[model samples]
Target: MILITGATGHIGSVVLEQLLRKLPAHQLAALVRDEIKAAHLQAQGITIRVGDYRDPASLERAMQGISKVLLVSGGGDEDGLQQHYNVVDAAKKAGVRCLAYTSRALQNPATLTNQLMVRHFQTEDYIRASGLSYLLFRNILYMDTLPQFVGPQVFEKGIQLPAGQGRVAFALRRDMGEAIANVLADDSCQNRIFTFTGAATYSFTDVAQALSELSGRPVEYTPIEEQEFMSRLRAQGLPAVAVERITGFLTDIKNDQESTVTAELADWLGRPPTPLREGIKEIFKV
Candidate 1:
C-alpha cells in the first residue's frame, strides 16, 4: 500500500483525492496525527494510520506494510529536520519499496541560504543514504498561496515589496499534487529527481499588469526597502518564524534565485501547467 504523510494538509489532501480516482481505496493509506480528525478519510475506505513525524515509534507503526511513501515537508522549526529524520528512519526500517519527499525547487538548491531549504537538503541527504529508492520533488512556490502573499486589497493598495525585477515560476498546488499522486501509483515514474515549476515566470510588475488587464483599472507595483517591507509585515503581527521564512524567499526572488522555469511538472501532467493569470484571477476573484 502507498502511504501519504501530511494526509490532511493542502498537498497531501489533494494527492489522496487524486489517488482515489486511479487506485482502489484498499491500496491507499493516510498517516494522520489523530484518527478522530480523519474520520472522513476512513469513511472513504482508506486505511488511517495514526502517526507524527516527531514520534519515531508512531511513524514506525504507520510504515508497516506500506510499500511506498510521500514524506511531505513540514515547517522550519528547530525540530523540523529531526521530524523528517524520524520518518525516513522508520521507512528505512520498515523496508519500504520507495520514499519520496516534497523538497524546494531551485536552479541550485545548494546555493540557497534559507533555513527551510537548508533543512530540506539535510533531509534529502538522509533519505539518500537510507538505502531506499527515492524521488525528490523540488517544487517551486505554489500560486495557490499567491493571494495570501499579495493580499486581498492588492487591486486597490497595489503591491509594495522588496522583490524588484525578480520573477517566480509559480505552479498551482493542485497540479503538483496530481503529478505526485500519478507518480505514487505508477512505479515507472516513482524514483527520479524532478524540478517542478510552472511553464513560465512572472515578476511583481507582471502581476500588476495581469491585474490591470483583468480589472481594466490601473494596478501598480512599487519596490520597497527590505527593512521597511519586513517591518510592515511584522506590524501585521505575523510570527517571527513566519516573517523570517517570507523574507528569505523574497530575498531569493530578488537575487534571481527563483526565476528558473522547468517543464517537468508539465511533462508529468502531459500538458502545460495552469497559467499564472488564471491562478491569480481565481485567487483574488477578479
Candidate 2:
C-alpha cells in the first residue's frame, strides 16, 4: 500500500485526491491526525490510519504493510526536524521500501542561511542515511502564497519587500500536488531527486504589474532594507515568529536563491504550468 503522511493538509489532501483517481482505495492509505477531516476519504473505502509525526508509535502502526510513503514536511520551528526524524526512523523500522519527501528547491541544501531550509536539509540527510530508496522533491515557493506575501496592502501601498531585482519561479500548490502524485504512480521516479518549478520566473515588480493589470489598479514594487522590512512587519502587529519567518523568505528572495526556473514540472504534468498573471487572477478571483 502507498501511505501518505499529512494527508489532510493542503498539499497532502490534493495528493491523496489525485492518487485516488489513479490507485485503488485499498491500495492507498492516509496518515491523518484528525479522523473528522478524513471521514470523507474513509467513506470512499480508503484506509484512514491515525498517525502523528510527533508520535513515533503512531507512525509505526500507520506504516505497517506499506511499500511507498510520502513524508510531507512538517510545519513550525519547534519539533519540525525532530518529527521528521521520528517519521524516517519509524518508516525504516516498518520496512517501507521507498520513501519520498517534499523538500525545497535550493541551490545548496547544505550551508542554508534560512532556518527553514536548515531543517529540511537535515531531514534530507537523515533520510539519505536510512539506506532506503528515496525521492527528494525540491519544490519552489508556492504561487498560492503570493497574496499572503503581497497582501491587501499591496492594492494601496504597493508591493513592499527587501528583495531588489530578485525573481522567483513560483509554482502552484495544486500543480505540485499533482506532479507528486504522478511521480509516486510511476516506478521510474525511485531514488531520484526532482526540482519542481514554474516555467517562468518573475520579480516582484513583474508581480506588481500583473496585479495592476488584473485589478485595473496601479500597484508598485517598493524595495526596503532587511531591518526596515522586519520593523514594518512588527509595526503591522505580526507576531515575532511570524515576522522572522517572513523576513527569512524576503532574505532568500533578495539573495535570488529561489529564482531558478526548471522544466521538470511541465514534463511531469504533461502541460505548461500556470502563468503568473493567470495564477494571480485565480487567487484574486478576478
Candidate 3:
C-alpha cells in the first residue's frame, strides 16, 4: 500500500489524483490532519488516516501496513524539522520499504536564504541514516508561485520582477506532482534524487510577454533593486520578514544561480514538462 501525507495540499492533491490513475483506491492511503477536509478523498474510495506530523503516535498509526510513504514537507512552522523527523522515525518503525520526500532544488548547505533547502537536507540526512530505500524529489521553484507574486498586479497593472533579465528554471506544480507519482509507481527509482523543472527556461520579461499575449493587453515588466521591491511589498502591507524572504529568492534567480533544470523530470514523466506560457494560460484560465 502507498500512503501520501499532506494529501490535501496543492502538490499532494495532484499527486494523489495521478497516483489513483495507476493504483487502485483501496491500495492507496491518505494521511490527513483534518477528516473534514478529506471527505472528498474518502468519497473517492481512498483509505483516510487522520494524523499529524507533530504527533508521533498519530504518524505511527498512519504508517501501519504502508509499503511506501510519501512524506510531504510541512509549511512554515517552527517545528517543521522535528515534525518531519517524527514521520521518518514512524516510517522506519512501520517497515516502509521506500520513503519519497519532496525537497527544494539547491542541496548546497551554505545557501543563506534557502530555507527549504536546509530543511530538506536535514530530512534527507535523517532518512538516509534510517537505512530505508529513499527517493528525493528536489523540486524547483513553482511557476504557481508566479501567480502569488504577480497575480495581484497582473489584474490591476502588470507583472514586475526584481529579476531583471535573469532566467529561472521554474516547473509547474502539476508536472512535479506527476513526476512524483511516476517515481512512487516504479521501484527502480529507489535511492535516487530527481531535480524537477519545466521543459524550458524563462526570463521575467518573457513571462510578461506571455501574459500580454494571453490577456490581449499590454503588460509591462519593470525591474527594480531587491530592496526597492521589498519596499513596494512593504507599502502594500506585506509582512517585513515575508517580503524579505520572497525578494531574497528573486535575488537568487536574478543572479543566474538557480537556472539549472536537470533532464530527470522529463525522463521520469516520459514527456516534456509544462512550458511557462501554457502554465500561465492554465493559471489564468485564458
Candidate 4:
C-alpha cells in the first residue's frame, strides 16, 4: 500500500482525491496524526495510520506493510528540518521501497538563501543519501497564495510589495497535486526529480492589471523598499515571524529567483496549466 502523510492538509487532500480516481482506495493508505480526524479517509476504504513526523516511533508503526510513501514537506516550524529528517530515517528503517517528497524549486540559489529554502535542499540531500528510490517534485510558488499576499484591499490601496520587475512562474496547488498523483498511480515508478512550474511567468504589475480587469476597479502596482515593506506589515499588527516569511518571498522575487518557466507541469497533466488571469478569476471570484 502507498501511504500519504499530511493526508488532511491542502495539498495532501487534493493528492488523495486525485489518486482515488486513478487507483482503488484499498490500495491507498493515509498517515494522519489523529485517527478520529481521518474518519472521512477511512470511510472511503483507505487505511488510516496515526502518525507524525516529529515522532519516529509513530512513523515506524504507520509504515508497517507500506511499500511506497509520499513525504509532504513539513510546515515552516522551528523544528521543521528535524521533523523531515525523522520521517526519512523512519521510512528507511521501515524498509519502504520508494519515497517521494515535495520540494521547492529555486532558479537562483544565491538569491534565495532563506531558511525555508535551505531546509528543503538539505532535506533533498538527506533523502538522496538514504539510498531509497525517490521521486522529488520541486514545485514553484503556489498561485493560490497570491490572494493572501495581495490582501483584500488590493482594489483600494493597490499592490504594494518589495518585488520590482521580477516575475514568478506560479502554478496552482490542485494542478501540482494532480500531476503528483498521476505519477504514483502508475505501477512503473522510478527515481526522478523534476521542477513543476507554470507555462508562463508574471510580475506583480501583470497581476495588478489582471485584477483590475476582472474586478472592474483600478489596481496599481507600487513597488516599495524592503525596509518599508517590513514597516507596513508590522504596522498592520503582523508578528515578526510572519513578517520575515513574507519578506523572504518578496525578496526572492525581487532577485528574480522564481522567474524560471517550465513545461513539466503541462507535460505531466497532458494539458496546459491555468493562465494568470484565468487563475486569478478562479481564486478571487472576480
Best candidate (score: lDDT): 4
Q: For candidate 3, lDDT tens digit of each residue in 198-225?
A: 6667888888899889988888888888
True-structure RMSD for candidate 4 = 1.1
On residues 1-286, what C-alpha lDDT tens digit does candidate 4 reach at each position? 8999999999999999999999999999999998898999999999999998889999999998988999999988999999999999999989998899999888866557365788888898999999998999899999999988888888889999999988999889999999999888877557899789999999999999999999999999999999999998999999999899889888888887888788899988999998899999999999
**In candidate 1, residue 208 scores what lDDT?**
90
lDDT of 1 by residue, 144-218 (tens): 877776778887898888888888998889999998887788865345888889999999899898888888878
- Count the clashes in each prediction: 0, 0, 0, 0
Candidate achieving higher TM-score, 3 or 4: 4
lDDT of 2 by residue, 1-286 (tens): 8998988889998998989888889999999999899998899888989999888999999999999999999888587999999999999999999999999987655544567777887888999999989999999999999888888778888988888878899889999999999999876545898999999889999999998999999999988898998998899899998888888877888777897789999999999999899999999876
Model 1 TM-score, all chains together:
0.95
Off by over 4 Å in 3: 107-109
RMSD of 1: 1.5
Give per-model TM-scores. Answer: 0.95, 0.96, 0.94, 0.97
Decreasing lDDT order of the candidates: 4, 2, 1, 3
Q: Which window of ten consecutive residues has the lowest lDDT sum in model 4?
A: 108-117
Instruction: Tell me the spans in candidate 4 whose CA falls farther than 4 Å from its real position.
Output: none
Model 2 scores a TM of 0.96
> Listing every candidate in turn, what is its Cα RMSD in Å to the true structure after a full C-alpha superposition?
1.5, 1.3, 1.7, 1.1
Q: Which scores better on lDDT, 3 or 4?
A: 4
Query: What root-mean-square deviation over C-alphas does model 3 reach?
Result: 1.7
Per-model C-alpha lDDT, please? 0.87, 0.89, 0.85, 0.90
Candidate number with greatest TM-score? 4
